[model samples]
Target: MTDQRQDAIPDAIPGAVPHTRGVRFAVYSAHAKAIDLCLFDGENETRLPLNRTATDLFALHVAGLKPGARYGFRAQGVYDPDRGLWFDPSKLLVDPYARELDRPFRHDARLSTFGVDTASLVPKAIVTEDRPVAPAAPRLPKGGLIYEVAVRPFTLLHPKVPAALRGTVAALAHPAVIAHLKRIGVDAVELLPITAWIDERHLPPLGLSNGWGYNPVAMMALDPRLVPGGMAELAATVATLHENGIGVILDLVFNHSGESDRHGATLSMRGLDNLTYYRHVPGAPGLLVNDTGTGNTLACDHPVVRRLILDTLRHFVRQAGIDGFRFDLGTILGRSPQGFSRESETLRAILSDPLLADRVMIAEPWDIGPGGYQLGQFPPPFLEWNDRARDDIRLYWRGDGWKTGRLAHALAGSSEIFSAHGLGETRSVNFLAAHDGFTLMDLVSYSHKHNEANGEDNRDGHNDNHSWNNGVEGETRDPAIRDSRRRDVQALLGTLFATRGTLMLTAGDEGGRSQQGNNNAYAQDNALTWLDWTTLDDDLVTHTARLARLRRRFDVFSESAFFTGQDGDVLWLNEQGKPMTTADWEQPDRQQLTMLLKTRDREEDRATRLAVVFNRSHDALAVHLPGGPWQDLFTKDHVFSPVLPPRTVIWLRELADPSARDKEAGES
Candidate 1:
């Protein structure tokens, strides 16, 4: 007899597909005894049995079924949770390949109980026809800045955004949003997850929700709540961003699903093939592996799981015109039974794929699993988020002793960390603050975390923030304290822009947005997290814009190669105008230093040198330089001054020739 798998359908792909006559549905399950397809139409349900076309494959073709049809699966088999078999015919399972969900997935207590009919509680997958977008190269420059944005919070309070368009993907394309992005010199916007996700079981009782979108259920489906227009909304938004020269990168959570521990809901993958989709303990099959702190981890090394991940990525790139992806808890992607490996098959496949080869790939590079911190270990072309830079930068500004060298190392792209892997250039994405922690304004305003608002009783965020309040904690009316905090914020922005490698700035960090010391504000969807455009410090905004302009006008700031300390590429100087000796660098109380670089002025088109001076002392310090014809980039002062302000960072450029001086004079 001929093979039934090949004879059933010729080169059939999984999920529901609409063709001329009708729609064909395919699902995969390694342990299910039988599976049935359930179609829904206005409170009426129809069940159709699917034939086992191939090993671990169940498929069926329903005549006259078209797009927008709502459907789900029900698998029949052993109902033993301890042995990793969770098949229940009464529970309506969502198709793993679902590209669109009829509605958002809501948490219900009956979802986990066996033999409980839950067709009403689960979201039915809607059949969608793919509208392919023409392939385009990612627009972000190698060392350009990436602005991290949480869509809803970023646009919810914007005055220019229409009330109806606010809190949706379409709002990102608004002129106000795009104009703000342009002012900050943003090359791309790294949006937090827009995929459909269910709130954590503990959130509903507390009257809070997961605003960060880290917990995802369907890999391919866009959350209906965030994108009501579904794929079309996202596609059009991307096209609009591209029109104004901004790329979009999605922050995806492949490490774990919204499905929590054993008691968690079995929405889709857990109900269809628990053993195959999720990772379980070696000897104890019933016990799930909690690599990600959220709950059970994905079995990324498995062939079926790898194919799903690849298809999901391809779907985003081909259908929605996404430029790139940032993998949350990315170590799990290279993880297996042995451990996390840099040479994992899934990582290699993504790098080699035709459609995805040139796309940007970023990794968080760490998880909570055994040996999970894999910083600087991802293969080439993958940039890793540099927590080392974040901590060291904070420490230096907090007046920690013996951190001058550490600060210098971070400013130079943390070569000590990335160079160990024999890489020629740095792959570090440097930032002082991110979505998971306190904002830049809060970093200097609150010395300790005040997480009482998170419902965790002040126990949710990081304790040692390496932060210091100028004089008062939280908000204050004292002008002295306010001025001190503003200077600190400006110094932090200057230091970040002066650093080598790619840069990232969380949404409102440049203009003094804060979460009131709630470092972990993942659950605060209210005004606490929204960007208050009206109350922004205009001085701080101008300073940030100037810094961005300097970074763009100077060639050295965007260079990715490690400085060799030769050919005037880099120099570290002390207060005495001499090269930093061993004793000077070893001083615990060292608060003043200078970094000199040989660079070219992009606009002037001439070779010049730049000096970035740092003063952390409480009093103004007189600093000496080894050059003449120096002009302060910010103050536009042609005359050189030896006195540097306390807790300030100044950029001084060495005028190359008479022509350059004349040009500067003409502009002034």
Candidate 2:
């Protein structure tokens, strides 16, 4: 091992950045007494001491180091768990800014703080020089459709996607995958966490791995298992999506790492400088604050952690050409020593960033911490996941009483929440289901979560699903029940598309994908989570496609402003064909209503007027039509008075002029 330092000084930042001659490896450890750069050559090892800067940043320049070189770090400091000073030189550490990993993580006790000589058990970081490039695509448009898909599950069973590119990021660029996205009228594809991650320790014992890549150890590094070609492959995928006019948004988990709580492994951040990297309990310095429910919460309030996250954002945006990001457990980003603040330095930095402020930014908006639910509290330019919409829509369609007002507020872009933020309905990303809960199919098929496969004895997932089994739970052979389930699914989806706000569809929901009632299938890497393309429901897929087409063609769904009611933009009516009164709205037995929407800023286009009738009762509803020649949106047939069947919906459009009818007929 050579103990030497090159002439050029390294940058006082984290990660390995390639320079003109060689690579400069920098790491921040404010509490560390010594830091060593370990270079691996096969089974042999060479340790070189790093030069400590005045800012407590350990750095070293090596002339021969280039891209793909495997390396790790060994931080030496006082080991005091109660005081939150955990550092051990014997345990190998990963670079928080690593762009790539040599291989997937294999769970071992030696990788923790209690083990020694853990050199071979840890994943090594590979050096890479990222070149600056312009963004391949523009930011997503307002009220665009965002499709959430897991890379592996989405393409693993595809017949057209090449087998070589099946479970990786490159598969997203395949002609078959791109064709499916375009056919669904998807504006943006939010790829779930592709960052290098570690399978939870308990999974291997049960013969499972985290199919969803939420437990990330390295933020900048793309997991080799997911992206074999690294950033090059990711860049190409982004470029292709841009060429096809579809933007790419990444689902990032910066709230926590794969490292668990006090009993967790000593991965990258924990071993580097645990005291400064993670937020310790206010009084009990040894324990971490469980804000994210992931065992450890990142100390984003710290300057070093802030810089690391910001650099990662820029790296992905400028080098990989990603259009935007959807932060997982995003509440942690705005959290501070006191609590979550809209004016936190971390949140301000991201919103005010020169390179990132204009890009599409989304937040999950809630965590498991105290006062974690901040759905409408996020600042401007951030679209939040609207769980309120999810629950209210589910409750209304599930035949729950006294939910009309809740559904109405949600359908209007959740104005009650976003209006106070000086934003409109477009600020809420509305969806029936997301990656965390029951899928759209399960939302109607199972009333209880079947998570026994997760090794938690079916006690791990949420119990209050607000779901209706229609008639039977799990699989049912009765064709009548099957038809009812199908109708219910259609109604939920129809309501979602007909509402005015941004829309998100989880992968395989169009074809009625289910996890056999498992709501939290995070650890199931096999058939349970993989999207089965073989037995797709053709009718359901067609219905979803039609809804997408409607959402895209109508201007009301994309309106940035809320309905003023006086401009004739919106109208609410009861089953008696009269404006709904306070008494009518409060009636628990009322199960049918009509919503009329006028196209925004397009009064000249008479065909843009739309009316939707929703009936959840057991009997058919007779809806009186407005004075116009109405045409069924899905059927393209003229109708005077329509009787909607029980538990069904009807969407109608006005064909006022002959030219409008011609245009409508042509579109149908």
Best by lDDT: 1
Error of 2 at 90 (Å): 1.4
What C-alpha lDDT, on a 0 to 100 scale, does residue 594 get in candidate 1? 92
Those runs of model 2 whose alpha carbons end farther than 4 Å from true positions after fitting are 1-11, 136-139, 422-426, 600-607, 657-668
lDDT of 1 by residue, 1-668 (tens): 12375355755677898988899998888888888999999678999988776556788888898999999999988888999889889999888899999899888888878889999998889999979999699978877899999999998889999999898999999999999888979999999999999988888889998898988899999998889899999999999999999999999989999878889888888888999999999988799999998879999999888998999999999998899999999999999999989999999999999999999999999999998999899998999999999898888888888558998999999898898669878999999999988899999999999889889999888898888899899998899998899999999998999899889999989899989999998889888998888888888888988888889888997789999997669999999878999888888789898999888899898888889999888789998987566889999678668899888999988866645655787799
Worst 10 residues of 1 by lDDT: 1-10
Off by over 4 Å in 1: 1-6, 658-668
Model 1 lDDT on a 0 to 1 scale = 0.89
Candidate 2's TM-score:
0.95
Model 2 over residues 494-546: C-alpha lDDT tens digits? 88887777789998998899899999999988898888888878799888888
TM-score of each: 0.97, 0.95
